[model samples]
Target: MTIEVYAMLKDYFEKQFIIKEQITDINSLKEYLSEQKPEATGILRSCRFAVDDEFVSDTYQLKENDSISIIPPSSGG
Candidate 1:
């Protein structure tokens, strides 16, 4: 699976990465990423996930060719 991170997440992790582990859903992905960087767990827990440009639920199934975007909270005026 192709993982793309944005905002604060990019500061902590690579902008993009590929994972071969059997990650079946967004929730699992979150856990995996958190384990990779324990310090980012708080942000990762609040991050939103998108698949192919569409926001997805935690249970959303993942596909090998799918691009997963981890979008951190943002603020604008």
Candidate 2:
């Protein structure tokens, strides 16, 4: 899977990267990411996910070669 991260998550991960783990759904992906970057656990848990530009839920199923985006909440003036 190709994961594209945004916002503060960029501080921890590259703009995009590939994961070979057999992650089946958004929920599991979150868990795996949190395990990889414990410091980003809270943000990962609250972040919104998008697959191929379409927003999905935690239960959303993931497919191999899919392009996934992890968007953390942001605040601006």
The most accurate candidate by lDDT is: 2
Q: What is the lDDT of candidate 1?
A: 0.92
lDDT of 1 by residue, 55-77 (tens): 99999999989999999999999
Instruction: Return the top candidate by TM-score.
Output: 2
> How much does candidate 1 score in TM-score?
0.95
Q: Work out candidate 2's RMSD over C-alphas.
A: 0.8
State every prediction's TM-score relative to the real structure: 0.95, 0.96
How does model 2 score by TM-score?
A: 0.96
Candidate 2 residue pairs in backbone clash: none
Q: Residue-wise lDDT of candidate 2 within 30-72, one digit each (tens)?
A: 9999999999999998899999999999999999989999999
Please state the error at residue 60 of candidate 1 in Å.
0.4
Model 2's alpha-carbon lDDT is 0.95
